[model samples]
Target: MATSVNRSCLTYLLHLAQDNLDFRLPEIKALLALRGKSFHPSGDFQEKTPFWCLDGLAEEDVRGVMARSVCAKSAFELWGHGQTHSELRTSLLNYPSENMSPFMHKDSTYRINVYTFNKTLEFPDRIKRIDAMDYLPFEGTVSLKSPQHIFCLLEDYGTDPNDIPEHPNYIYFGRWIADGQRELIRSHSVKNRHFIGNTSMDAGLSFIMANHAKVNENDLVFDPFVGTGSLLVACSHFRAYVCGTDIDYNTIHGRGRSSRKNQKWRGPDENIRANLRQYGTEEMYIDVMISDASKPVWREAPLFDAIITDPPYGIRESTRRTGSHKDVTKHADGIYLESHVPVSQAYHLSDIFTDLLNFSAHHLVVGGRLVYWLPVYRPEYSEETVPLHPCLRILSNCEQTLSSHTSRRLITMEKIRKPEELDGLAQFADGRFSPYQGHNAFREKYFSGLNKRCIKEDNKAVVNGQ
Candidate 1:
């Protein structure tokens, strides 16, 4: 009863990686939501900082989040924290004895680690910092090799690197729980993957998107513009059943020219399924087909648990769908030879998002999520520019800057209710709701200083080659 009482009052501290400052909070919150918990910060929360103190979470909850997060480095059961060492000592001494006794018993073995953020410490200085903690009642044996329990003393010298302070701005001491999945970023890097494409999503961002979608084991996830199956690979890592559709027949069949260097053509067995096999998740692979996103192929029912994709922005890859504007007289008897091929025309950016939201509203289960990327021209971008639908509610919008004037926002939305006739008509009810209307216009804005005609011709040649 005493242990439970002490644990309930305890606050946990998270040591996060400094990169991707905008994404860490949502990732942690979504992971906590999976375990039926809410984010409760203990103090003034600063999103850009490396340390976050959270309240109302058990050790198991912390461990669960650490197991999956790539943005966080480690989590700790915070014992004490303060702006100065003297204050920290007072806080530590004031902590309940019952909470510390369990891990500090004389029969146990433990290790202490000193971590400094935005600063470096010499070996002797690190040892001095550890020695300064002699006031704590640590009766356990010190084992540096393999300890049964680990504790950490973390110091934050502030985020600015140029101005070095004589003392740390903040300090925290806690019992370490678990480290996050940062290793996955390195292990699944696109440079090392067996199959890849020019616009393959980065490994870290792929996992981050999966988390934002709340992907889980046994869930059905779909990607509309699944180039090289990078997003599928991330979902499969989380044990979700993955499938996708792409308009590019060459990509779907894994044929034609290769995206890899020093390779002329793709080899047999060099496809999405093989990529999953390389990651030991081949069983999660459902299928990848050659189909246009502008057209509907699925039945009229809620099927997917999540819809996650990265649509082409006409910057690195051309956006084309199955259709032609030129009037074509029907063949005699409406029959064509087997050698005939379907013609493709430019797919507008606005129409792509309109069809996407409508498709998601009809195809995603209630409470399901839809995650995708929206390219934006920085000067004109605003919340109103995001595409909207009646059945879907906006959850998060995180930006990844590509250039001085261009960025892509990762937009996540949830299906609140089933679609209705009235709902479809009311999608643009908001006067401010405006979607991207043309790929050429966006491309022109993206490449304002360059020769527009030459760029368009170059893009046409590249598409023709593919």
Candidate 2:
């Protein structure tokens, strides 16, 4: 079912003891298959398989099989994945204890790639089983006494009988990462498809969360103002149907490029003419229309599992549009969003952030999540917190300022079943004495306090009878 090159891809799932050994199996299997590794030897393609984690390298390399494994050790591991598994093996055979102690060893023979399909795999602990072999000592000053790496071999006698060169008794987890996986990831890469300079977000953060969001095969994902179609591409990586919309012409063109059977691209980026040549999207055209944000709507569709986007925050792209006949130029006041690349037409989208949020929520499935990024800065304090949605339970003494760009808050929220969940919409007037107010003392009192006018009283998330 796969080309020989891909079939030979050595897929391995390294897990530590007590970790959720089988937790990521299904997703991993799907990801690999989506990536194009549908022909693994593991059969039935079960996850939670255990593999040996060596203790010779750094802990960061060891944690890479886990989510938070992006530490210094993992940096080396990712490097290792592409080349030199044998060199690392040789080092382990010799200096088993350099960081942990001193790695010293002697010549040894035989190298094995193992997979643990049944139980938990922990390094050093399970490695004790090797005691019976009296394996050669680790060479030189780096001895086994202090080992920095950790690992878990799947089983004792599991081996893949193949003509692969170098070592025997070598095992493989599945196959190399699938081609489909790369394409899927690439399709959503913020860097690859960055059509709008400052108006787009990458697939990195969403990809990370999708790994933890507990999604299923048929769930749907939505991205309003879907700049360059990054979120939709990432969602498809998880096998979820994607629905994206945007207001730009190029964005619409790029999104519409692929009209193939493998995909069902819907909304603004729906140019089936170009897409069919490259992918497997549907013949049923994805409906993308140019509607005003203040008044937006989509042909009736199913509710969505998540709402993911990064909207303009007035600062990066000033919400103010300036025109002098010949050409128009706009600017954001340095909104300090770390990954944000400011766009030119920002001035045209000011304070409309609320409208965007309201429209996005209108489509989210109850209990579904809404993830977005915003920029917020407090003049009194230095440094800004990013991805701020996780910490909000209530609002108080909040000042809304047009972004001069110090902090762009990333707001991610879920569409709860009831309005009481987030108090609907709450407003804040800048107090004259407030930090945002600067020195205007007379305006402080009236500008401050609970904003009761914007609160929605209906069971619905908001109200706009029209």
Candidate 3:
């Protein structure tokens, strides 16, 4: 049995509120057990209210899940007395698990997440020397889980200005336990701090990674063409050595969106590199290197234990050109894809598959899985437009069953039974990049498991009470 000391919380980072808490939480408990741990639900929640409470759970039961012996940080003082607050300019975030079974549920678009911290929100504070108890209405459920430098600000009191905390604690929630106001926004409160932007990749896949707190520690994981370094960032946070690469310097992994094609300074030229610094990695610091994955150098036995990547668009289009940052600032949330290059200016989808399969054949180790995407447009458009690679097998289509935007068909492949038979799969190599989805690798981990275990495990399954 995996001892409690060996168990770390599995945090699920995905689109908040898309599925009910019931399906997501219980599955997390099961995933822990899969990692060889004795599991139990300490507490779980939505954006608002207590999903699980320590009051009902015995102290022993609470201790079962809150294994401090294996915690990353010794102690975190969140929700000490009143409300804690913080803000972020990125995609996802993390916090210890909490209880949330109250408040009425809302629509699919209104996403939220709930959390609990170590001995936090346990007892109300009574410090009066700073007139602490009644000062500034400071409180519990503070946003201490944030990776951002500023969280839980203490209101500027003593007019001296310098007397206050650098970014002091602001809001306060007493023993009353008021639910968080921004629960509906799935930033730091629920989603894992993987990618830089919100809702770019599949949230179901992102949720699984963000929610995952621990893994086979020290495992060597790879995310080829890591869009914005989302999968790799989450993997690093989940206790692994991460590697990611891309074709050019205009992506999340690449240099800032704006550089000089004509030697003119445009925007924050150091943004992407600076963003990576915050996560504690430098170029080549990780096991990754920039190169074309189409005809990659494959080792018979890969030094890497796992592989995850979001490849370039078979038809990629974006605004990540040499001077796109200035334009992005003028655009909304840096989302306008105004200028760019064609991913595959040469051929359509068929050539892409042949090359992609050949790349996987040589690079992906035996028993190592390759999870990728296959978009099937609405049923009516039937012209065999999307190319198919013979080696890659269709695994599942959970997204189609749940979402309305576009359904993704999950695909997977292992080494051919006989190595000599690697003839047909072409040598696809698309050089273009887009800022949209790099969920290729992680979604495989999420759905490939479902494809193997439960057939009905998806967003709709939660609503249908599976």
Candidate 4:
């Protein structure tokens, strides 16, 4: 009981990668939620910083989060921290001797690493920092190559590159636990992907999306607008059974023009399943079919464990669906020729989200998440613009900036209840609930900024005569 109490009170330090500043917290929180844990900061917390001190987690809980987190670089069992070396010494001396004795035994071999955020230290300086820790009782032999235990001395120089501090703003020392899955980003990069499209999701962002959805082993995942199946690839990597639908026949069959440079056409072997196979997750691939998002073909039941997708923003890929402005005439027998082709019409961004939310409400299991991107004209964006449904609740809204005037928000929502008869008509009854209809003009606003920039460049060129 005493050992368990000591373990429960232990604080853990997380060294998060500085990139994707907006996504690190949500990703970590979702991963912790998967382990049935809550995020409890030990002190004043700064979300943008590289170091985070957490409480209310066991060593196994930290390892479980590290196993799937891409935002975090490494986790440690915090021993002592302070703003100055003298204070750190006092803190370390005040720490329980029993908690520090196991790893510092004479028979053990260990190594210490010096990590400085937003700064670099010379070899002599790093060695001096290690020497400064001689005040602690460490009887273990130092092993530089391989060791049974690893510890780190982390210093924060602040986030600003313009201002470099002579002394660190904060300092922390801890025993290393485990490293996060950052290597997955490099290994699964779209640049090296077998099959890709014009708008394939980035490898890091793809994994972040999967983490945000809390995808787990054997979970059934679906993507409504699965272009070349980048999101599917991420989900399958997490051991989920993945499938998707797209309206483009060529893309669905991988017979279209190649997305690779200098390659005019895609090879027969290049397809969504082949991409999964390339990563040795072909068993997770269920199927990919040519279908429209506006007209889902799934049965009326909560089937999917999670829905993750990146819908077309009418920029790189035109938002379209199977439909026509003109009326179609049916034969007396109500049949059409097998060779007849259906026409497609513009799928406005507003209606696209409406259909997506409604579909998720009907198809996603209770507590299942729906993660997707929503393009925004930054100047006119507001919380009210986000689409809402009676059965679904919004969880997170993170932004990825594209240009000065344009950006995309990664919106995560969960199904809290089944849809009722009035749920489908709730948006119509309330104007605020349907403000996304104004987003139909997103494409126009997106291009208007570019046109203005071009005109300005032209005026400057005319003023400064060649």
Candidate 5:
């Protein structure tokens, strides 16, 4: 037993939330990268499992990850684990005596918690499970209310809900380290937000986007299509100075219709600034303006540390940009008259992504991140359809299904190089660039799916009448 025990070596176990399964690993990797640590899994590592054992990290590193992770529930310092209860007993008994002695001292007070995944145990059954661990030496006084130390016995019954086994597939014993920032999701929910739009991002996803951007303190984050400033709010929470621009005058100035069911008009203080103030991060609010994304207002050279945004998908809002008629003649000095109103033209989805990538390539500092959403028509979607650029490297692509036939992918990329004059004017013809021209008809595809569904329902109604 002593041969198998090593007091100095330790592993940490992460209990990750089951939802947003695809985003969890990238979020964890990004957070770990913030501390200059790489993820090193112990034994068998499964991405879909709720439980994961991680090696090559200190307790402080685990705490750092928990501080920012919304996808993880809690972390633990692993003592032992095994496939069977008998195997677990052997593993626990072999755990270094020195490592166990410090927490089990007679003067200390501790509690043992029973945590079961995918199954619930009755009171009697839970007590029986706890009582079965009598072989180990725990000299500490049992404290139910306020324990100086907390230990957990976790049982994994596998993921299938309908086919639960009589016993757990695996068992683990560990010391509870820290709980993650899952509460942020509830506290920052869009339903309770001071200001929101019809397509305001959910709180959980907003934070996830910020994480993917690797937002840091004192960083400058920009959102070119900042509708209602949801992304700005998330960046501000991380102590980053947040600013954005929107083509919609109403959205930028917060003068449009209220998104709430009963409210007809927006309140006096219902704006992005008020949102930051609501969360006590108003000091990080840089400012927002009304501008066209195609024509950036920033001066030459890298200006932002990160650019995170969600461009208009034409599903909830119209995609329009400032334009001038070909017949409209310019003045002798090549300027528009003061009385001329800007013409609005349809902003195709293809050009939207092309201009966005070009803007980020030129405006973002090298190594800075660009995180955005790309709408998809499920039947026509493929890896080849995603837009790309020479200077930006794709980091992660995660899909969030909207309906049976429609979905959107969250794309994260990092600016790797500055664009030269020739590269800037390359017209996206390089092998590396896969222009999203095919997606220009996304609006039509989206509505066609809806129309098909409606027709199918109508046919069903007619058949039932017969």
Candidate 6:
């Protein structure tokens, strides 16, 4: 049996994970946007808070959001909420009889659970809290082992550990709906993955990036700086056709030293395609190639539905691209050998982003997304440092702190217009479209900080020994 669904207006509660606080809002909004809807909060909501009460959503809409959200832990149909226990009782009393009657039938089986945030309670204390909810006319028989209906009494004790409140700051009672796909983190852990590399992305963040890109079935996703195809693995899980290009021939061919401990060399079939096969998404594997990002090989047409990549940060991998100032030795008729290995030159951080934005502007379908990481020297970073293009609009930028002084931001941009003939050349001529000067010096700043840390550690060790 189902109650009348007011599709346009209903309140739902989302219990989000505490970590990745910066990514929660964008993830939810992106998911909602996929459904042709927008996020509408009912109360004074804080983005960092664990609980968010959203209006303008039905149970199905909440379930849909949870289906793709890694930041959300669970969601529920909000029956009632209040600032205090007495207020909660009054709120519960005001809930419509018809709305509360469905799950409280005399013949139904039900259970009530007590959950507290930022505080722990004894078993008896938890029992007492559940007993206090007896004021609700739950005519159903209690079932501890297996319940037909599960209701939760959630209490918020505030986020501070030092100043614990004796009473909850807020309370919510709701019917448990669905849980997010957070298990994907543990299941797709890089430590247990079949093929990985020195800078293989963590599985959780890869899924986050995929979600931010709004990748869906049959979508063609490309990673320009694919190292061991971590982003491709994440996209393939969503049933997207995945392909990539990397400057490192060894990475493209999977014919080099192993990244795993105790392994001398990479084994046969140890490649990106094999990774998809291991996860049973081999059919989604498009071909990967050895190519420089600076000199793209794709035709001048909108091809990729989404471009998701993590360009080298010069920490774990050397950032180099093919070509040198020295003239190439020419054979008869100015011919170069097919097997010739061109000398690689330092690919500046600024040029990498400029070329990427230009390539995405030309290759991405309108409304398609481009998601990539931008390494930052924390002190010098600002909104201006992010690369820009006239045809692409920046959607969201979330930072993941790596150290005290270094962080990498996940920048998501959506292509809004087709590239004009001048679009490619405009980025070079226009100073506004160019990357901020600070970004150009990231490589130098990164090493300076690293060297300082090493020196500080050495000094600390010497003093401790003395």
Name the runs in model 2 displaced over 4 angstroms.
1-200, 209-216, 253-285, 296-302, 314-350, 378-410, 420-466
Best by TM-score: 4
Write out the backbone clash pairs for model 5. Answer: none
Error in Å for residue 340 of model 2: 32
Error of 1 at 71 (Å): 0.6
lDDT of each: 0.91, 0.38, 0.36, 0.93, 0.90, 0.89
- Alpha-carbon shift of residue 371 in model 6 (angstroms): 0.6
In model 5, which regions exceed 4 Å deviation? 1-9, 329-341, 425-429
Between prediction 2 and prediction 5, which has the larger lDDT? 5
- The stretch of ten residues in a row with the least summed lDDT in candidate 2 is 70-79
* Candidate 6 TM-score over all chains jointly: 0.95
Q: Model 4: how far is 266 from its true place, Å?
A: 0.7
* Sequence-dependent TM-score of model 1: 0.94
lDDT of 2 by residue, 1-466 (tens): 3443332332233432323232233333322333333323322332322333222322322222233221011111211221233543443454313221221233322232233333334666445534422343434332244433322222322223243334223332111111112233345554534232444444444453354333335667666656545555455544567666655544566544333334454445344223321334333223444333454566433267766666544433323222234442333773555543333332233234445545544556665666555444344323222211221221111122433323333344555443333434233232221122221221122223112222433423444452
RMSD of each: 5.2, 19.4, 18.8, 1.4, 2.7, 2.0
* Candidate 2: residue 283 Cα off by (Å): 7.4
- For model 3, the local distance difference test gives 0.36
- Given candidate 4, what's the lDDT at residue 445? 91
Best-fitting candidate, scored by lDDT: 4
Question: What is candidate 1's CA lDDT for residue 455?
Answer: 83
Candidate 4 lDDT by residue in tens digits, 155-202: 999999999899999999999999999999999999999999999999
What is the Cα-based TM-score of model 2?
A: 0.40
Structural similarity to truth (TM-score) of each candidate: 0.94, 0.40, 0.41, 0.97, 0.95, 0.95
- lDDT for 225 (candidate 1): 98
Candidates, ranked, lDDT:
4, 1, 5, 6, 2, 3
